[model samples]
Target: MPQLLMIEDDARLAQMVGEYLEQSGFVLTHATDGKAGLALLEAPTAAGLPDLVLLDLMLPDMDGLEVCRRLRALPSDAARLPVVMLTAKGDPMDRIIGLEMGADDYLPKPFEPRELLARIRAVLRRRGEAAPSARIMRFGSLEIDRDARTVTVAGEAREITSYQFDLLAALAERAGRVLTRDQIMEAVRGRELEAFDRSIDVHMGRIRAAIEADPKNPKRILTVRGVGYVFARQQD
Candidate 1:
């Protein structure tokens, strides 16, 4: 069973979610605040860290975004840990902000348990498929080493979240092909794109910032207007 750490302050909702997830064959550890969640994450226990984190954006102690940023700043494996933010805010910007802060995914409040389960499964599945391979891809000064799960530009390591790395890898693997948002989502997460979903675009911007010398004039990943995006095969 996959272990999950849920950082949510609502006692009753946490109980309900914990029960549902446990019944669905997941082992859940609940933290009522961001501090507690970070503490648990930093502790090196014999059991190791949980497979994923379900972080609540509104926390009693600190903003969930701060927690996420701190988590990514950690000098340990916790930095790259997969996070899915849970928020009650209805604004799409909240979701986009969370994604920009390195969250793998997010679920708005009032979501059905089934949808939550599906999201969890999709995130976990993506992580599972991130195993190292022997293939190495290069374009100009950019290098993607599948065996090490690392990306470098001009011989310098580029800082990117693990999910963003996967997204870039997916696009690079199909270089020169214009892949629709739906196709990119399916390739990365094994799920269809949701209506009005701009998560892919957000991730793409982040990836470009990391790899492109000038993100404003990206040469590797090119946009295809209404179609989607393509990784350029030729480098100038």
Candidate 2:
């Protein structure tokens, strides 16, 4: 009985989705707008916060992108909660922006319930994955603890979305190897890249923001011009 929170303004769509998701053994808590959704997440009971969030891009109180930004700014671990964004907008830019805002996945409107379920499961799977080995890779002040699924810089913890962590791990695991976007996506077991390959770049930027001392001139993750990117084995 995984708990889920959905922040959507459409009553009919929420009801329909709730029913379908419940049938798949998930318990859903519905919030009609962004404020209510944020409130629920900000203050949780002893049972704790929802396992994941299904956030809609359009809300009555505030836009979903803004909501997502607020959610990521949360002080607690709730900031790392897996988020799957839903939007009617067909523009890939919206989806790209959502990823930049820390969303774990994105789904367009008029989508099949099955696809939605699959995406939710896929995101949850990634969130739940812990490295089989308790190996912590250290590069200068940066540290990637695969067993704990946490990243730290100079002993200070950094926040990164689950998807971005996987992307970073994918590069770090193959340190010094240049991997193209397609190869990186494959290594991450990502199935959500649709119509936009630059999504990888968006995620890389976010990862850099978290772990790099200066994201503007990243020394850890370097670009290979027309090729892909490689993680520098030596960092200053």
Candidate 3:
């Protein structure tokens, strides 16, 4: 069973969510605040680090954004740990900032337990599944390892969130093919392209920043006006 760690101040809510997830075959552990959560993550217990983190945006101690930044800075495999932000804020900026800060996904507050469960399953599924195709995909200096779920540019690892990595893989797998926004969204699992959808663009920009020599003028992923994007078949 996959292990989960949720950092939330709302004890009742945590209890409800933990129980709900437990019934679905997940083992969820809880921390009331960000500091304790960070501590637990820094020095994992006998169970080791959890497979994913359900981080709340409004932590009582350090803000969830700061926690996420620190989490990504860890000098261990835990740094790449998948995160799903749980925010009460409806602002799209909150979700965007969370994604930029390294969250794999986000769910708004007062969500149905079923929705939460779905989100959790989707994230874990993406992180765990290695495509039946070649496990390691290489394009010139850029490399995408499906088995390890990592991307490297010129042999140096580039940091990208789980969902963003999946998006890059989808494009890279079909290099030179122009995939429409709808097609891109369909390629990546976890979430659909909702109304006012700029998530794909945001994630693409982040991916370019990681893999391109110059994000302003990317050579790896090219944009087609009024259409979609295509990953370059060859890189300089």
Per-residue lDDT for 28-104 in model 3, tens only? Answer: 88999999999988877544568799999999887899999999998765788899999898999989999999999
* Candidate 1 regions with alpha-carbon error over 4 angstroms: 133-236
Q: Which portions of model 3 miss their true places by more than 4 Å?
A: 130-236
Candidate 2, residue 12: how far the Cα is off, in Å? 1.0
Candidate 2 structure quality by residue, lDDT tens digits, 70-135? 999998657988999999999999999999999999999999999999999999898778424338
lDDT of each: 0.84, 0.86, 0.85
Model 1: per-residue lDDT, tens digit, 1-236? Answer: 46788999998998899899999988788999999999988873333467789999999999899999999998766788899999999889988889999999999898898899899999988876885443998877889998898999888999898778888998887664567777777777753444554888998999999988789998788887887888876554
Best of the two (1, 3) by lDDT: 3
Best-performing candidate as measured by lDDT: 2
Model 3 weakest lDDT span, ten residues long: 188-197
Q: What TM-score number comes out for model 2?
A: 0.56
Task: Count steric clashes of candidate 3.
Answer: 0
Q: What TM-score does prediction 3 earn?
A: 0.56
TM-score per model over all chains: 0.56, 0.56, 0.56
Error of 2 at 23 (Å): 1.0
State the displacement of the C-alpha of residue 104, model 2, in Å, after optimal TM-score superposition. Answer: 0.8
